[model samples]
Target: MILEPKMIEEVQAAVQEAKCLGVRGQGTKPALAMAWGETAVLSTRHLSGILAYEPNEYTFTAYAGTAVSEVITTLAQNNQYLPFDPLWVEAGATLGGTVAANASGSGRYRYGGVRDFILGVSFVDGSGQLVRGGGKVVKNSAGFDIPKFMVGSLGRYGILVELTFKVFPKPRSYVTLQLQYASLHAALFAMFKLAVMPFEMDVLDLAPELAGKATLIIRLGGLPEALPGRVERMRGFLQEQTEVETAVLLENEADITYWQAQNRFDWAFAASQLVKIPVTPKQIPTLDKHLTNTLRRYSAGGNVAWVAADDMTALQTTLTELNLAGLQFTGHTDDPYLGSRKGRRFAQRIKKALDPNAVFSTND
Candidate 1:
């Protein structure tokens, strides 16, 4: 059964009556939502709209079910945007779903992720109570940081009813440089070199190419007139300091479309499973060796891995062998978690405190 709640009181009542409930927004991630088994799915579709927006203060509050696309459009009109670049917006991802999934895109490389921008949240707890945390303003720092805790919580703690986020002025212009390297080692070396420099890169991503080669994708955002010089300087730096084979610069509509494709996961459309794994650059070389047949991309300077694979069992085995954990977003599975588990003990403690009745899914 599915329940669509249109208000806080409705959400509270739904939680109060349901034996076990799974929360969702638009159902963009069906695998993760369905992991709750036979529970009634609580859809936040009807509970939508922006509540408040303060352009001067750079903050906005909206219903949890508010479409991320709407938020982006509204912010664009104000010459501002969410710097973390919430992902899956074009795919009908809701503000609440993005927060619950912690789905930030490549832009997170500069400003940080979903947890960094979220200032406040209102949710219905397991006991059918409405709870508010943090503040609508940005200077808030008085509570238990329940807002941050709700990030990536996947409704295990509470069902987010509304959220407030801090945004930044949108950059006037943007450019992307795609640098090719003969090998992953060379590309990684270039990434390390670029990381230390003050390039102020807005995005740094890596992807493997044929024959063990790799491509380093970098994005820069700033004044329109100043972008050309900056792009040349970046190209010159890589050419002189690293073993970069070639560089392709994208601008205007091309640059916009490229990133949109990435944010939409267009390249991984053929894969049956899409999983996100937190990783460091140092661990990527070893991890890459095992993902021979999978499609993967490294974002945030190799701080995160998005993997698309057809063989779920094989991927799970590889992650387990490497002592890594992954959260699946697509495909079927009894559990969305794969490989070695982490933070279970602490998560369980929080779950007990927030949802003692076990009304919500136990997964994090």
Candidate 2:
């Protein structure tokens, strides 16, 4: 059954009785929230609203159930936005679920991810007690910084009720470039070089084309008057330093469409199973060599990859063999996460401390 609690007290009361509570928000990633089989669904739908927003302070607090689009809309009105570009779920994702999944988009290439922007949170622990961590203000960095620990906890420790995040002013102008390469190695070699450069890229991605061809898309955000000069300078640098065959600057609507499409993983989601794999620039060549058959896109300047594969077992086996971390976003998996065992042990310690009763489920 779905239990929607309107307030913290009600949430506590609901959690007090459930043998296990599968935290849910808008039911966007059902594979996560409902993967626990017979457990009761504790939805944050009713406990949604903006608690506080201070544009001048560059911070905002909203209920766990608040729609990400709603927060973005509010920030847009004031020329401010979440730098992390929280992944937008087509099934109407909520901010809480986004954080729980630790889903950040291509925009994170410049600034950071949800963990970096999150300043504080108010959650109901497994013990049915309300716990607050960090603070609403940016400078308030006192104590354990438990707020960030929740960034990718997947609601196993607690149910996030209220969340606070640091936001940034939107860029004045944006310039997008399509850099085409003759091969995957050539494209990734350029991507690695770009990663260490001084130029700030708002978004960077690489997608494979047919017949050993690949394309690297770079987005630059800055003042309108300075953008053209910066774009030309970067183009020249890439041409001189890397084996880039061609570079074309995207204009207007096409740029927006391409950027948005990357954020949503439009190509990967079309397949039967969609997976997000985390890999560093140094690992891209090796990872790409193994994933050539899959429809994939390398994002965050080659720090992560999103792939669409029909065989879950093969994908898991491949990831295991490569020693690359991956998380299945769609379809069934024995375990959605393929992170290191050391990381899992650390998570287990936190889980024990925050959820002694084992109230929340982590199964996929």
Candidate 3:
């Protein structure tokens, strides 16, 4: 049933009768929406609209059902942005869904992930109790840091009702450079070198190029007047230190389109099983060896790899062998996650306290 609760009373009533509930938002991520089958669906689709926004304070509180695109559009109007750059794989994606999944795009390379920017959240527990956690501003919380734990929770503990986020000022201009390398090995080597440098990059991604080659795309944002010099310096360093076949500093529409297409994966893998894999730059080349036939790109400065492969069994086996974890965005899987646990003990403790009756399915 659509849990379009206009107030806390409505939410309590909705949860009161359900034995097992599958908390959902827009169902943009099909795999996650149906992760737990046979459970009653409790959609946050009705709890829409921004509750509060203070552009001057760089913070905003929105209902859980608010569309991510809506939040982004509002923030952009004030020369501010959610630094985490919530992943928008599908158009109807909600802010709550993105937080629950802990999905971020290439922009997270500079600052951090969704957990870093989240200030607080309000949710409904299994007992139909309205609860809140974290603080409204970017300061210490009054109670437990439950909001941070909610990241990647997949709606296991409770159903998120509202969320508050810390925003950042957008840069005046952006510049992107495409550096072509002979092979993935060379491209990754250059990525490692750039990672340790003092230069601040907005986005860093490595993708396949023509003839089995590789391309390293670097995006820098700042004052329009200062970007030209920074771009020249970066270009000079790469030319002198690495074997770059070509260096092209993109401007205007070209730069915008490249980054947009990267996040949307609109290149070649439009019809393949897409998965997000967590790996270090050192592990990228190794993963690339197994994914030779897949269309893939390393995002977040090589910390995350987005791969599109047709064979699920092969992909899962490869991930198991490499000792890496993966979250398949699309496709069927008995277990959606293929990775080691993080904070399992702590998560279990919180889950027990918040959902004592197991009314919600975590799909763990």
Q: What is the TM-score of each candidate against the true structure?
A: 0.97, 0.94, 0.93
Whole-model lDDT, model 1: 0.89
lDDT of each: 0.89, 0.82, 0.82
Model 3, 1-364: lDDT tens per residue? Answer: 5456666677788788888888778887766777475457888877889989999999999998899889888998999988887776446789889999888988999999999999999888999998878774434445457788788888888888889998999988898999999998888888888988988999888987536789998999999999999988888888777899987888878887877776666764656767889888888877888878788888998999888878878887888888788887766555567655556687788788889888887654
Ranking by lDDT: 1, 3, 2
**Considering summed lDDT, which 10 consecutive residues are worst modelled in model 2?**
136-145
Candidate 3's TM-score: 0.93
Candidate 1 per-residue lDDT over residues 1-364, each given as its tens digit: 8899888899999999988888899888877778366468899978999999999999999999999999999999999999998887888899999999888899999989999999999999999999888884433456468889889898899999999999999998999999999988899999999999999999999988647889999999999999999988888888889987878999999999999999988879554789999999999999998875678889999999999888888989998999999999887777888898988898999888889989997655
What is candidate 2's TM-score against the reference?
0.94
lDDT at position 363, candidate 3 = 52
Q: Please identify model 3 stretches exceeding 4 Å from their true place.
A: 1-3, 136-144, 209-211, 339-346
Between candidates 1 and 3, the TM-score winner? 1
Q: Rank the candidates by TM-score, best first.
A: 1, 2, 3
Best by TM-score: 1
Using lDDT as the measure, which candidate wins?
1
**lDDT per residue (tens digit) for residues 57-130 in model 2:** 99999999998988988999999988998776445789999999898988898998999999989899889999
Which is the winner by TM-score between candidate 1 and candidate 2? 1
